[model samples]
Target: MAPRQKTAGLLDAVGPAFSRLRRSVLLDVENPVPAKDLTRTLVLNIVEDGADGEVTVGVVAERLAVDPSVASRMVTDCIGAGYLVRAASQRDGRRTVLRLSPEGAATLERFRQHQRVAFEYITRDWPEQERLEFARLLLKYVDAIDALRAPA
Candidate 1:
């Protein structure tokens, strides 16, 4: 097979792999993580890692590529779940910003640990160098996507 055809085949496999990964997480009932939902993780990550001065619902909406109303509802859910809190903005007391609560931080850490465990378990048979290289490439792929999605 030609190189281009091989690449096309690889890309074709990626879609199903991604779908399966998504479903695997949803089907993960054995883990007792409360913040198992992807939206919760995303909202918590945005508040924890993407905070710049003030992270508002608008910011979440923009970052999540979601509608303002949808972002509002999601943020509200996060707040209700005690993963996030609405606080007064530093720049303007009247304005509001999102902050990760202590529980949010702990939950994020636990979820991340859970992911690490899952990765290790799945790749336990792989050689060390191969596992490390795959991890590096996966992170690079996501970083490239983030860069491409960022506004110029």
Candidate 2:
């Protein structure tokens, strides 16, 4: 097969693989706190990125590649569910910043553990070095995609 065809096949496979993974591990998990898919995703992002400081809704939208209105609604729902908290940004009092609640952090950890176990099971037969290389390559691919989408 030509290189373009090989790339197309990989891209085709990625969509369904991601959907299956999300449904099996992330979206369908039973958690102590009930949350929609977007809410759960937002919590996880906040846990990973909000530790340094508060994360803004705009930032979440940008990271998720979603519309600002969509992100705003998800953030509001998360706050109502007690999974996230919004506070004034220290740097700019008028600006709002988001951080996960303790409950949100705990829930995110549980989800991470589930994902880790699932990945381990799926890659159990792969050699350790191959697994590490796969991870590195996946990160590189994602970064390349991000760079392509970024404004020049």
Candidate 3:
């Protein structure tokens, strides 16, 4: 086979493998806290990143590429699960902010630790140079994709 064909085959094999790997790493049910609801968990995580210790449902919906109502439902589910809190903004009564509670923060931290351990295990044998190169390549691809998706 030509070198081009070999590279194409390798890329083809990588696509499904990456999908399965991503799903296993991100949506594993055997996790200590488990992923009972991925959409809710993801929204809660976004809230955790806010400087105000919370994020608005509208912003989350924009980030998630979903409707405001869908994001509100996810927030409601997270609230019911005790993973998040919904509060009216002190400065803007009309807007609602979602926050991760103490319990929620702890759970999120544990999940991060699990993910770190998983990545560490997976890359344990990887050479430093190779890993650095992989990171650069991945970032390049990500940037290219983002550029394409940017509004004209």
lDDT of each: 0.84, 0.73, 0.75
What lDDT tens digits, residue by residue, belong to model 2 across residues 2-62? 9999999998999899787655654444442344644565545654565358688887787
lDDT of 3 by residue, 1-152 (tens): 99999999998998899789867765543343465654555776778867364488887888789999998888788888898887888778887777788878876777777766666666669998887787789779978976785679
Query: On a 0 to 100 scale, what is the lDDT of residue 68 in model 3?
Result: 92
Best by lDDT: 1
**Ordering by lDDT:** 1, 3, 2
Give a tens-digit lDDT track for model 1, residues 7-125: 99999999899989866763354464554455698888888866565899998998889999999999999899898988899889999999988998988898788788778877889
Judge candidate 2 against the unseen true structure and give its global Cα lDDT, from 0 to 1: 0.73
Output the better candidate (1/3) by lDDT.
Answer: 1
lDDT score at residue 41, model 1, on the 0-100 scale? 89
Tell me, what's the RMSD of every candidate?
A: 2.3, 3.8, 4.0
Per-model TM-score on C-alpha atoms: 0.85, 0.70, 0.67
Candidate 1: minimum summed lDDT over ten consecutive residues — where? 26-35
Residues forming the 10-long window of minimal summed lDDT in candidate 2:
26-35
* Model 3 weakest 10-residue run by lDDT: 26-35
Candidate 1's C-alpha runs over 4 A off are 25-37
Clashes of 1: 0
RMSD of 1: 2.3
Model 3 lDDT, full chain set: 0.75
On TM-score, the leading prediction is: 1
